[model samples]
Target: MILAVDVGGTNIRTALIASHGGTVQELRSRVSLGDRGVSENDLIEKLSALFSEIISSHNDISAIGIGFPGFFSAGSGILLSSPNLPQLHNVDLAGRLSEAVSLPVSMQNDALCAAIGEHRFGAGKGHANLLHITLGTGIGGGLILNGVPYTGESGMAMEFGHLRVAGSDLPRSCGCGGSGCVEAYASATAVSAQYFERSGIQTDAGDIYERACKGDKHAKEIIESAGHCLGMAIAQAIKLLDIHTVTISGGFAGAWPLLHPAIIKSLDTELIPPLKGKTTVLRSTLDDTAGLLGAAALIN
Candidate 1:
C-alpha cells in the first residue's frame, strides 16, 4: 500500500491506496495555522505527527506520496515557493517527510496530481491529450500530452489561472499581482467577492450558487460572468494545444448546472470556426479523491 497525502492551506488529508488503485483508509486533520504567522518547523512538526499516527496503525505501507500546493524543483522535491505556505519556501519537503517517517517519498504539484488521477482513473481516462482545471480558492491547471503528464521545464507549465483574458480597458486584479487574469473572475474567491460587492452580504461561493438556483438574478449573473471568463480562457488554451477534452474539478464545480450554459456559450462565440463545438468539458468522477489517488500513483 502507498500512503497518499494532500496538503492544503487549511487541512492535511491522507489516505492509503492499494497498488491497483483503490483507497484503503483515509484521514483528515486541521492544519490549525491561524492568522498568526506560520513557521517551517511548525508545519513540519504538524505533518510529522499526523504521519506518525497513521503509520503506527498501518504496517503494510511501503512508500509515501504527497500532493503539495506549491512550485517545486520537480526532480528534487524541493519546494520553491507556495503562495499559501510561504514559510516552507526552499525546503526539501519530500526529503524531510521521508526522514520523519523512514520511507521513500515522491511529490508533485497538487493540480498536476489531480490531472494524473483523472487521466488514469477518472474523466480523462482514455484520452491521449487532456486539460484539467481545478476551480477553488484559486484556479489551477494540469495538462496531459500524448499519454503523459507535462510540467514544462520549470515545473510550472500550466498556470492557467494567470492567463490574461481581459484587455487593458477593463483590468481585473489578481492575488498574483497581475491584472486581467481569468482567475480574477473565475475562482471561488472571485465568485464570492463579486457577490458580496454587488449584494453587500458576505457569504461563500456555495451559498451564492444556492441563491442562483433559487432564481436570484444578481447571483445568477455573477456566476454566469465567471463562467464566461472561464470559457474564454479555455478557448485560448484549446487554440494553442488543440486538445478537445477538458475536465474540471473543485469545490465550485458543483454549480455546473448554472455555469455550463455560460461556458458553452462563450466557447461557441470565442472558438474559431473549425474548432467550434469540438470541445468537451467533463466533470470529475473521483471528486476529492483524485488528488489522493494521484499522489499514490506517483509512488506506485
Candidate 2:
C-alpha cells in the first residue's frame, strides 16, 4: 500500500491505495495550513502527526507520496515558493517528511499529480498528449506530453492560471498579485466574486451554478463569462503545445452543463483555422480521487 497525501490551499486529504488494484481507502480530511501564520516547523509537525496517525492503523504502507501546491525543485523536492502558503520557502518538504515517517516520499505539483492521475486512470486515459486543468478556488494546469508529464526545466511550466487572457484595460486582480490573469476571471473565487459584483448577492460558486441552472440570468452570465475566459486560456495553451485533448476537474467543474457551451463557443471563436475543431475537452471521472491516486502512482 502507498500512502498518498494531497495538500491543497484549503484542505489536506490523505488516503491509502493498493499498489496493484488501485483501490483507495481515504483516511480523513484536515484543514490546510493556509494563511494561518503557521511556521515551517509547525507545518512539518502537523503533517508528521497526520501521517503517523494513519500509519498506526495501516501497517502495510510501504512508501509515501505527496501532491503539494507550490513551486519546487522536481528532482530534489525542495519547495521554492507557494503562492497560497507563503510561509513555506526553500524547504526540503519531501526529505523531512520521509525522515519523520521512515518511508520514501515522492512529491510533485498537485495539479501535475492530478494530470498523472487522469492520464493513468481517469478521463485522460489513452491520451499521450493532453492538458489537465483544475478549476477550484484557483485555476491550475498540468501537461502530459508524449506520454510523460512535463514540468519544464524550472518545474514551473504549466502555470495556466497566470496566463494573461484579459486586456489590461479590464483588469481583474488575481491572488498571484497580477491583473488581467485568466485565474482572476475564471477561478471559482472569481466566479463568486463576479456574481456578487453583478447581483449584489454573496454566495459560493456552487450556489451560483445552481442558480444558473434554475434560470437565473445573472448567474448564467457569470458562469458563461468564466467559461469563455477559461476556453481562451486553453486556446492559448493549445496554440503553444498543439495538444488537442484537455481534461477539466475540481469543484467548479460540477457546472459543466453551463460551462461546456461557453467554452466551446470561445474555443471556436478564438482557435486558429487549422485547430478549430480538433480540441476535445473531457470531464474527469475520478473527481477528487485523481490527486490521491496520482500521488500514490508516484511510488511505482
Candidate 3:
C-alpha cells in the first residue's frame, strides 16, 4: 500500500493506491496552505493527523508518495522554487512528513507526476510518447518519451507554458521571467484576468465557464482566446516532439468545450503534413485524484 499526496498552494489531497498499478482509492483529506492565516505547524498538524488516522486504520501501508507543486530536487527530497507555496521553498517536506508518519516517502513535481500517471495508468496508458499539459493557474506540463518520464538535464524541461508566442500584446511576468509565454494566455488565471480586464468582473476559472454557459460574452471571449493560445502551443509541440498523445488537465480543461474549437483552429494553421492530424488531444481520465494517484507512482 502507498499513500499518495498532492500538495498544492491552496489544498492538499491524499489517497491510498496499490503498489503495483491498479485502481487508486482516494482518501478524505484537505489542508489550507500558506502563512496568511495559517501556520506551517498547522499544516504539519493536518498532515500528521491524516497520517495517524491512515496508519491506525490501515497499518499495512508501507510507503508514502507526494506530488509536490514546485521544483523538486529528488536527490535531497527538498522543495525548490515553490512559488505557489511560500512556506515550502527549500523545506524538506518529504523528510518532515516521513518523520511525522514514520514511513518511507518520495516526491516529484506535480506536473511531472501527472505525466507519469497519465502515461502509466490514465489516458496515455499504452503510449510511449506522451505529454500532460496542466491548464490551471499556469500552463505547466510533463513529458514522456519511450515510456520514460523525461525531465531535462537539470530536472526542469518541458516547461511548456513558458514557450513564447511570436507576436503578442501580452508578456509573461511569470516566476521564470519570460515574455508572451503560452501560460500568460492559456492558463486559467490568464483567462480570468482577461475576463476581469474586459468586464471588470473578477471570477474563478469555474465561474468563467459557468458565465460563458450563461452567455456572458466577455467570459466566452477570454476562454476562447485561451484555447487558441493553447492550441498554438499544442501544434508547435506536435511539430517538434511528435508525441502520440497530449492530455489536458487542471481547471481550464474543465472549460474545454468553450476552448476546443479555437485550439483546433490554431493548430490547423501551423501543423506540419505528417503531424497535421496525428496527435490526439484529450481530457484527463483521472479527476482531482490524478495528482494524488500520480504522486503515488514515485514509490513504485
Candidate 4:
C-alpha cells in the first residue's frame, strides 16, 4: 500500500492506493487543505497531521508519493517555485515531511504524475507516446515519449501551457508573466476572468459552464474561444513532437461538451494533411484520482 498526495492550489488530496492490473483501488480521498490560503508552515503541518491520521489507522505503508504543482528539484525534493502557491518557493518540502512522518517521500510535478497515471492505467493506456494536459486554474502538460515519462534535464519539460500562442484581445497575462501563453487564454482562471470582464458577473469557471449548458450564448462564446486557443496550442505540439494521442483532464475539463467542438474545429483547421485523422484527443478516464494513482506509481 502507498500513500499518495496531490497538492494543488485549491486543495490537497490524499489517498491510499492499491494497484491491480492497470486498476487502482483508492481507499478514500481526504482533503487536507481546502480553498483557504495557507502559509508554508501551515501547509506542512496539515500534511503531517493528515499523514499521522492515515498512519494511525493503517499499517505496512511502503512509501509516500506527492504530486505537487510547481517547479522543484527532482533530486533534492526542493520546491523552487509555484506560481499558484507562491508561499512554497525554495522550500525543501519532502525533506521536512519525511522527518515528520518518518516515511520516505518521493515528489513529482503534478501534471507529470497525471501523465504517468494515464499512461499506466487510464486514457493513455496502450499508447507509447502521448501528451497529458490538465486544464484548471492553470494549464499544465506532461509528455510520454517511447513509453517513458519525459522530464527534461532539470525536470522541467512539457510546459505546454507556457508556450506562446496567438494573443487574444482580452487583457490577460499568465502566471509565468507572459501575455501570449496558451494559459493566458485557455485556463479556467482565464475563462472566468474573460467572462467576468464581459458580463460583469463574478463566478467561477464551473458556473460559466453551467450557464453555457443552459444555452447562454455569451457563455458558450467564451468557452469556445478558450477551446480554440487550447486546440491551436495542441496543434503546434503535435506538429513539433509528431505525437498523436492527447488526453485532456482536470476540474475544468468537465466542460468538454463546450470545448470539444471548438477544439476539433481548430485542430482540423490548423493541423497539416498528414497529421489529420491520425491524432486522438481523449478525455481522462481517471478523473481527479489520476494524480494520486500517479503519485503511487512513482514509488513503484
* Tens-digit lDDT track of model 3 for 1-300: 998888776777777889875777777757555454444567567777777888889888999888876777744567665656455456677788789988988888889888888777888789888989988887789998998777676566788998876657556565457668888877878777778888888888899899999998888888887887788888778888887688878877899788877887887777877678777788888745567767788885
- Leading candidate by lDDT: 2
lDDT of 2: 0.88
The reply for model 2, stretches above 4 Å from the true place, is: 34-36
RMSD of 3: 2.8
Candidate 4 residues 1-68, lDDT tens each?
78888888766777778634244555554464643456888878988988888888889776788898
Q: lDDT: which is higher, 2 or 4? A: 2
lDDT of each: 0.86, 0.88, 0.78, 0.84
lDDT score at residue 82, model 4, on the 0-100 scale: 72
Q: Model 2 residue 238 lDDT?
A: 84
Off by over 4 Å in 3: 36-50, 74-80, 85-96, 170-172
Could you estimate the TM-score for every candidate? 0.94, 0.96, 0.87, 0.89
Q: Which stretches of candidate 1 lie over 4 Å from their true place?
A: 33-37
Ranking by lDDT: 2, 1, 4, 3
Clashing residue pairs, candidate 2? none
The lowest-lDDT stretch of 10 consecutive residues in candidate 3 is 31-40
lDDT assessment of candidate 3: 0.78
Q: State, as a TM-score between 0 and 1, how close model 4 is to the true structure.
A: 0.89
- Using lDDT as the yardstick, the better of models 1 and 3 is 1
> Clashes in candidate 4: how many?
0
